[model samples]
Target: MADKSNAESIITETQKRISNAFDVFDHESNKTVDVREIGTIIRSLGCFPSEAELHDIIAELEDEEPTGFVRYEKFLPTMTKILLERKFRPITEDLLLQAFEVLDQQKKGHLEPEELTKYLTQEGEPFTQEEIDEMLSAAVDPDKNVILYKDFVSMMTFDDTR
Candidate 1:
């Protein structure tokens, strides 16, 4: 029963995250976004990757269909499985601090919206203005454009139980 509940929780979380990604993609472009966009979207959700790294994601999607525009249904399980498998670097407190280091362009101890956007793009993870704003609102300090170490840590740490 516990295992079933855990699976259900993971599925629900995956659905929420993927839904957010779809909204982010739609916000990024008025027209249809392709499967290649998945890498960028996932990265924007705070994953980092180089050009080569992103290509792997695109390649995986391409294997499913040539057009590369991964519909929401396709993206959810792919990403969820990736998360469950611990494929990418683990989301740890240390990693969260590193993300701030990457995002804090001004070195001002905080991350402004522009800085975060640039950082995300630099990491090859493109984000919509709305998505950037949302992430900032959730975790960043509006006054300083930086998130506190604790807040950043909290954002990345998963309870697994919840």
Candidate 2:
């Protein structure tokens, strides 16, 4: 079903991100990143966890040496799961509708292309123009030249990786 493919896509995306993050943060290329590197990685993602919170996160990971280092191969899945659940879990229909309402300032019941672009490129983790274009290409209704709330929600939730 669509849900199964979506889950697979999510897993695949998470794994790719995790691998890239590990490569970026593992400065020494030791196949592991230290606790400090871990904190830096988290901060790079626009999240700032307290020292205690960071410690708790590392504690949850099973480390062979307990040296405050995360081995990419050993901990990638856990890291991906944590990132997906904490930051990228699927949005609920009600939440999506409410967000659409907020964005649809004129209560037009749909978003014009410009409005959608603005929303996508808003401050804090802004999307690139290419990304916005790709999203619009997928979500926009060809006949309407706009994105209805339902279509937007479905596009946002749909994952094609079966």
Candidate 3:
């Protein structure tokens, strides 16, 4: 049987792999990541945790503030749940790369609402035009079609009703 130290080491190594997977999906090239981006990353990994799954994970994550935004300290365990829920089995780096290519539709290193909606709909989880409009409203300036990385990250990080 594995010793306690060995088990801890294994856990650390698994977390490392999960973190690397997240790095691949952090399209803004920023260290700070967001949950919608996380959802895309999870889908890329061949898993689709429902909204309920994400809510439960977020609820359990330490450092959730009264306002409900997770602090950087809580981000790792929260992301770990998305990246390594099915055990420490190795996830392919190629898959991560492919997922990035898919998500980076504009090749701008940030996600646009239209891009996200199209991708989700392609996967059979459609987002209505109104939902797309609302999501875009959060990130885009009125009459603007482009989304800055900072705004995009903020929108992706925050949980929304739509």
Q: Point to the candidate with the largest lDDT.
A: 2
- Please give, for residues 68-117, the per-residue lDDT of candidate 2 as tens digits: 67887766766765676674234466777898889888988888889878
Candidate 1: deviation at residue 144, Å? 19
- Cα-based lDDT for every prediction: 0.65, 0.72, 0.57
**1-162 per-residue lDDT for model 3 (tens digits):** 469889788678757765676677666766555655655554544455666775666566534354433344466666555444563233344554456466776677566656666675676657677767786677665556655545455444422211
Root mean square deviation (Cα) for candidate 1: 7.7
Could you tell me how far off, in angstroms, the CA of residue 25 lies in candidate 2 after the best superposition? 20
| Least accurate 10 contiguous residues by lDDT in model 2 | 153-162
* Model 1, backbone clash pairs (residues 3+ apart or across chains), number: 8
RMSD per candidate (Å) reads: 7.7, 10.3, 12.3
Q: Tell me which residue pairs clash in candidate 1.
A: 34-69, 35-68, 35-69, 35-70, 110-145, 110-146, 111-145, 111-146
lDDT, candidate 1, 1-162, per-residue tens: 999999999778876876776677764454345765676677655555566777777676554547646555556677777666655543667767777776565666655556666776676657667777777777776567656646667775754432
Question: How high is the lDDT of residue 150 in model 2?
Answer: 76
Better of 2 and 3 by lDDT: 2
Q: On a 0 to 100 scale, what is the lDDT of residue 5 in model 2?
A: 100
lDDT of 3 at 49: 62
